[model samples]
Target: MSVRRLRNLLLVLIATVTLILYGCSDEDPTSTSSAGFAGLGQDVDGFQDAGSNSSLTFPADHSAHPDYRIEWWYLTANLEDESGEPLGLQWTLFRQALMAPSKRPEPTPWAADQLWMAHMALSQGEQHQVAERFGRSHSQAQLNTTQNSQAGVVANPFHAWLDDWQLKANDEADNRDFDNLTLTAYSGEGDTRFGYSLTLTAEGPLVLHGNGGFSQKAANGQGSMYYSQPFWQIEGDVTLNGETKTVSGRGWLDREWSSQLLDARQSGWDWFSIHLEDGHKLMAFRLRGGGDDTDQAQGADYRSGTWITPEGQATSLANSDITLTPQATSAVAGRDVPTRWRLEVPSAGLDMTIEAPHANRWMTTSVPYWEGEVVVTDHASGEPLGEGYLEMTGY
Candidate 1:
């Protein structure tokens, strides 16, 4: 979301002011550049952009893309307990580097040019529990020596970690297909306690988004390498408010990396991952602002996604292929946020209205956002179609 822009802005702004008064120090390499939303839109120096010709390799792609300015390992789940009450869960690992790969600072003990942040949440009924943590590590040594640092990610067998929180391979198999994984995370204490211990197994193939995984975020060609595994069958245990219970459901995992994640004027994004009852999966997202003048004049936004069949075959979608209209809003975190939407993809024969049964999925972090489970239904008849997750950032 806006996590990268916020972190980069705050750090760079503070460092710039400090340098102006006390001069630049070795510990403070940050300058007051446009590292915020506007900075991200500008062409970056040193790092690599997501090129159309770039290809993705299996186990390596699942690990890390530190050469890029920002990357994340994100997961969201739609679950139900024994009584059939609905529940939602989310866990994300975000890594932002101060410098590109070639400019990595010397791996001196405690020296670093990278920052890591993690967010975890669980919601049901009117209850929502969330937690966030931040850490720092050297790009080179951080991955090698994981004793001190509280966060990191590895390739072989596939594992992403932050302190005790982890989403790792479950079995010892070395095929490296990345089909099975174990996700463990928790936060808070006493009556506010909440967490999950779940296992995820792929029921379909990995889905490459946009053109062979190069997901364009702007009409001007700025974008990221994006992909997803959206057919996960999950089963596990969860603790809510000091009570533990068995839970089973489905999940989706998204991996994306880029030097420029969005355009300068783009405010934010609305992303959706829907699991239909008929076994189909729909992944769609809209980037607000900064599209071409023609589309902008008509109030169009940068949109793209993939429609996945039960077997994982994916058809790439373009901005003209879909339409997302917010139909309702709710007061969350003191902001009126869209919690209901009408989604349609005419060529794909999809016309559905989706709404969040629980509208308070606000993640009050350093970069605040709203994300939770939602239900989809027929646009005309209002009949239930499926359930999935929704994420809205930057208001």
Candidate 2:
């Protein structure tokens, strides 16, 4: 069969398997069960687990990792008003696997292993708003067309986007460097809904996380490949409360993928990525559950990241050196979220408290969570340090 034709066939088969596991819903629910619409839990099987043996490549390597089970392109920015008050924004897409294609128990229409989710949020002063959406697809389809599955990195064009929110280089003219990118997003209804259409320029090189993208997540070798571009100078327009404003700031982009995310015993995680005033970047996270902060499986906590300098040198951070704590919780999207945090990195001589521009930015996805932009301040002196994006998943 032709490549396109074969691809569609695979998609259809996968979609069929997916229908058997996850029931389809246009409105979309936040749970994992397909929950009986049709085509789910009809078949079961076991197969040899595939192993990753491929070497990493640039540009293209920055693209998709479909062979694996999950991936995400995450972006968050910290902006300021004319009077210098802070604002925060976030846009992210997450892909997860319901089942491996080879493990189908039975075959039926619209069953597959692929699922996609997206979240967008905006925060300014005391206002916060968030939204989320989800969809499913087979790797192959009969008509050669699919629904809600378009995301990847293009080397030459230097673009990474999903659905409406995008980050693409403006290189059609002459710039080879992906120095300029456009970002846009919108949602909600009447005057209550809002979004931002903006441009971001690269001010520094991309930072690879955890030993050239091999980030360890659990003690058992469960982890992800991760990277980030944390120095994009941004400018654009934001529309909130039916009012549009010209804004400028810096943005950070993080990409991570893995077959296993949460340690099976862990209940949740609190993660932070900060861009410091001194031109260095700091990131840290803690997985909760399994033990009493002492057990390797249940109480065991894993944390590590890169501290990137302006000169482009990166230093690995150890768990013993960094500390993260939730300081406050507030209501968001019908759930309580810890929107305030205390972070410390002794090796970098840094201690700060991070707080959201607003407390309501929550993405209600297949796995609902809180992810948004935050402002950083000195923990001891209460001085403004810088800003960043914070994510709390599995809460």
Q: What TM-score do all the candidates reach, one by one?
A: 0.89, 0.77
Query: Candidate 1 lDDT (Cα, whole model)?
Result: 0.81
lDDT of 1 by residue, 57-117 (tens): 8878888777787889999999999999999999999887767678787887546677677
Clashing pairs in 1: 34-39
Candidate 2 local Cα displacement, residue 229, angstroms: 0.5
Error of 1 at 273 (Å): 0.6
Candidate 2: tens digits of C-alpha lDDT, residues 216-296: 664545467777888888888888898778888888888887655544444557788888888888878776542234534
User: What's the lDDT for residue 370 in model 1?
Assistant: 88
Q: Which regions of candidate 2 fall more than 4 Å away from where they truly are?
A: 1-55, 98-113, 135-155, 171-179, 290-298, 331-336
The global C-alpha lDDT for each of the candidates, from Candidate 1 onward, is 0.81, 0.66
C-alpha RMSD for every candidate: 6.3, 7.4
Question: Which stretches of model 1 miss by more than 4 angstroms?
Answer: 1-42, 142-149, 172-177, 295-299
